[model samples]
Target: MRRFFYTIDSDNADAPLLPKLSELSQGSDIELPDSIIHHWCRVLRANVGDQGILFDGFGGEYQVQLQTISKKKAIATLLLHLDDDRTAPIISKIGLVMSRGERMDYAIQKATELGVTAIQLLSSHHGEVNLKPAQVEKKLAHWQQVAIAACEQCGLNRPPLILAPLSIRDWLAPTESPNNKTAVSPIVSTLSKDKYYQVLESAADLRLQMSVPAAGQPAKPEILETVLKQESPYIELLIGPEGGLSDDECQKAESVGFAPWQIGTRVLRTETVPVVALTTLLALYSYNK
Candidate 1:
């Protein structure tokens, strides 16, 4: 069976009335979203009685069977609920500096597959891309959709939230709270309200900055060893752009309690940092067990 993300849009009158997937009951027939209709009905040529999976990013997924199909509309009947979130063992939020073109998409896509809880888009002094006011909405939506699509492909039931872009200075400001309403993603703000997604709003248990490999730096941050000892630890990772963070930006991040984490002797591209960093943590986690 094919899996599809059932995104919520409370602001739209035609959107589903229920915000969370858990609210939907078995044996109920529900209208499919436009995105799903296009992919499953028209493009895939799915017919009535075809079965598939639907997830709303609240928690679990549902087994559904197509009941109706039309050019612009489709309906599926919920058969059963599968309570498998398939989330990563650790909760993480990566403060990723924007890159250009496919690099940005690759970062978000791979991060979602690795079970990142949230991503905070940052524009640093050495960053490649910075969105203007007009570009923010479109770009943010595009990135969020990228994460959603990754979830559909990777069997991650709960999609990671892609936050709105903020400057490195503003994001690291002592007075700035991570939960500030201004930084909320437009796609998630008005849609589902899950407690799991709210975890990123709070301060993380550990904060690590992916620093360029420098001589005399510890191979692994001591704090990482300490944090992973706890159950389901929450970590915040800072990854810079292609050229890496400026001296001042790095110093500011250090002042804000971000410990330097140099993975290996080799230098990594901006897009590759997330994948390597996440897998390293997972490896460490398994070794500790």
Candidate 2:
């Protein structure tokens, strides 16, 4: 069976007949999202009785069977709901600097596959890509779609929220108290509206920066082991750009409680940091548990 992300456009009158997943029941008909129609109906040439999986960025996925197909529209019937949760044992949001072209996409894709809770897109002193005011919406949409496609391929039911890009300085500024809860990302708030996704807005239990390998830096942060002991520990990671964060930026990050985490002696490219750092974290989490 193929998989499709069921998107709802509450403001669009032409949205699918079943706009909300709550409206779905076994044997009930659901008008497939437009994106799915193009890929499944026209491109794949799907036929009646074809089965596929569907997830709405909620907690679980659904098994559906195509009942009707056309050049412009398609319909599927919900077969069953699978309540399997494959989220990471530790909750994480990477403050990833935006790189150019495929590098950015690759980082987001790998992060999604690793069950990241969210990605806070950042523009650092040496970051390459900076969206103009006119470009923000388009780029955000493109990146969000990138995350959605990654979820479809990786079997992650809850797509990590791709937050709007922010300056590293602003992102590091302590706006909220450690105990204060911040507001959810506008993107997730508009599309998801789920309590599960809201957890990303809360203060992280531990914060780490993927620091450049230096002689004196510890291989890993000391607090990481203690933090991973908690149930569903929320961690925030700061990864710099290719040229890396300036000395001033690094200082600010440290002042705000981001412990320096040096992976190894070799320097890693901006795109590779997330994969290596996340894999290391997952390994540590599994071993500690």
User: Which model scores highest in lDDT?
Assistant: 1
Candidate 2 lDDT, 1-289, residue by residue in tens: 7878776553254543345575677788888767888888888888898899998876688999999887777888989999878888988999999999999999999999988888888898899988896887678778888888888898888888888888887788747435432333333444545688667768899999899888888988788999988878899999999999999999999999999999888999988999998898899888888
For all predicted structures, in order, the TM-scores are 0.94, 0.92
Q: Count the backbone clashes (under 3 Å) in each candidate.
A: 0, 0
Tens digits of per-residue lDDT for model 1, 50-162:
99999887778999999988777888899999988699999999999999989999999999999998898999988889899999888988999899889889999888888
Which pairs, if any, clash in model 1? none
Model 2 Cα displacement at 212 (Å)?
A: 0.9
lDDT measured at residue 54 in model 2 versus the true structure, 0 to 100: 91
Query: Once superposed on the true structure, which residue ranges of model 1 sit more than 4 Å away at CA?
Result: 10-16, 174-185, 190-192
Question: Using alpha carbons, what is the TM-score of model 1?
Answer: 0.94
Which residue window of length 10 is worst by lDDT in model 2? 179-188
Model 2 CA deviation exceeding 4 Å by range: 10-18, 174-189
